[model samples]
Target: MAATEQPISYAQDIKPLFREGDRESMSAAFDLWSYDDVVQNSDAILGKLRDGTMPCDGAWPEEQVDLFQRWVDAGMPA
Candidate 1:
């Protein structure tokens, strides 16, 4: 049997990436709380991730980053 394919969900996958309290802090510049917010700002998101400018810390683990890229490549689905 073939492996099941799971669609990435914003509420399930993406939203968890951001810290709860900090979500509002970045809202002034970028809103990452919803599907539209991520889709609209995907370029900045991916670019920042690639350049290691996001997370205000450092690069996320390779697996997590890959997951994010996969979500992006999958059209930033909700």
Candidate 2:
């Protein structure tokens, strides 16, 4: 984290990245909106995101993926 960089949190940052349909589609696997689930599965999720295999509709923008990676690297905060 840089001096001016704000910390990332699940509620304020990561959770909103998953859409309602995303949560519905991934319900069988895990709840995308759940902090614990996400934290547990963050690595696999990041791999899928990086490879454009998540969301199942289309890949997220590079910036969004980068944001996710940043959150993960930042200790999967909150």
Candidate 3:
């Protein structure tokens, strides 16, 4: 639940959970996450998910939420 506990690779675990490779619904952590303030705020992104403001297309599953949370809880590893 802490940043230090994050897994090393974002592309490996986190990317796969979302539409990263789908192209149609693909979401790059970098695109959603900017180098500025937003990149560091995982909750902001998750809040969108939790409040049904994400994808702008559809909602992610709870399991996907957990995966995203884990990645966020893990410090949004790059």
- Model 1: pairs clashing at backbone N, Cα or C within 3 Å: none
TM-score for each predicted model, relative to the true structure = 0.80, 0.93, 0.57
Worst 10 residues of 2 by lDDT: 1-10
Q: Highest lDDT: which candidate?
A: 2
| Alpha-carbon RMSD to native, per candidate | 2.9, 2.1, 5.5
Which ranking of candidates, highest lDDT first?
Answer: 2, 1, 3
lDDT of 1 by residue, 1-78 (tens): 123577876778878987755467678877777678778888888787777777776777776776788788887778
Worst 10 residues of 3 by lDDT: 29-38
Count of clashes in candidate 2: 0
Residues 1-78, candidate 3: write the lDDT tens digits.
Answer: 344544634666655544543334434443442323334656677897777667677778786777777766666666
Q: Once model 1 is optimally superposed onto the true structure by TM-score, how far is the C-alpha of residue 63 displaced, in angstroms?
A: 1.2
* Residue 59 local lDDT, model 2: 98
Instruction: Rank by TM-score, highest first.
Output: 2, 1, 3
Please give the lDDT score at residue 6 for candidate 3.
Answer: 44
Provide the overall lDDT of each model, using Cα atoms, as 2-decimal numbers: 0.75, 0.91, 0.59
